[model samples]
Target: MKISAELRAFSGRLGHDFARPELLQRALTHGSIASTTRPDNQRLEFLGDRVLGLTMAEALFSADRAASEGQLAPRYNALVKGETCAAVAREIGLGDVLKLGRSEMLSGGRRKEALLADALEAVIAAIYLDAGLEAARGVILKHWADRLKNVDSDSRDAKTVLQEWAQANGMTPPRYVQTARSGPDHAPEFEITVRLDDGREAIASGQGTKRSIEQAAAQALLDRIEGTT
Candidate 1:
């Protein structure tokens, strides 16, 4: 399989050359593509998810001397969250490098936040495999620096914040339910609703990314319940 010049140029810009360029190719491949033609990126996505977490944890530890796991976990979670990853993928033009099936391409898979985010993770995993942990760490730190920079005390996880808000006000913790799910098996969009004890509810739609959409739903609930826009 021929890797595009654009992808090569992009990887060069990322400052690391993949020894297994095929990993990069697999990273860019979505499940929507025909299996015989293009390999799916799911395995890489799984590996990348853990690689990103570990890399982010190391970065946070090195950057902040005083932060505990309590403080660091949320920041790490926020940094590697799907929305942030999708944003980074878009910033790096990963969608343009994606190999999609004709139908998925027409369905705008390139523009879907979930696909972009998953592909980004796959890329990170590929980087880790092709090069090493350090190479992947560099890529993550470079792309996620801004998000990581605000990783001090104020950086609370959405679920924690939501729960705290509910508890402080003498209310019960919020509950999450899958209100709806759409799309094919490989690429599904989820609609989650966050509900409080008194039946006050906030609904939000998101993609396959659990962490991101959960945070989004939590944010929506926080805003609505607190009446703070």
Candidate 2:
């Protein structure tokens, strides 16, 4: 089958020319558009998640000999999280080539974080199937080079750090409350508040799922407390 110019360009950006182009096609297909003939990327996404985790884990272990498992765990999580994957997808323009159903297209599915992240994982799996583990690792490291180098900055998520701080200080866990949600059903902005038992609190707004917004709010509070941002 002749690959489209767009898919060809995407393959270039992805740094892997698929021997089996159908894998790439399947990876780009979304559940919204899936049929018996066109399989969605869900299974690929599942496999890619594990592939990504293993790649990151090995990279982190090799990069930091002095760092203990305690330190490496969080860095691995930061690198493999959905948000990070979505950011990488955006960098590669993965969203532009996504094959979405009509409803998804109308609902701004191309820009959705979850969709972008999932597609990226599926693409990783596609590359793995087409090539090998080394190929998959090379692609992941190429895209995540900067993040891996600066992994110290994001070693722990804001929520995790905040919880650790609270526990250390003998306070209860932080509470996250969604104050408001606005926008169309397809896209929404969330206003969330993160409160500590000791009365310290912070409010922040983000565009995406409630969990992400809540995490952003917690991060905001942590930044304020730590005077980092």
Models, CA RMSD each:
4.4, 2.5
169-196 in candidate 1: lDDT tens per residue?
7888889888888987656788888888
TM-scores of the models, in the order given: 0.69, 0.87
Candidate 2 stretches greater than 4 Å from native: 163-175, 195-201
Task: State the displacement of the C-alpha of residue 21, model 1, in Å, after optimal TM-score superposition.
Answer: 2.3
Cα lDDT, all candidates: 0.82, 0.92
Which residue runs of candidate 1 sit more than 4 Å off their true CA positions? 157-229
> Clash number for model 1?
0
Quote the lDDT for 197 in model 1: 84
lDDT for position 77 in model 2: 86
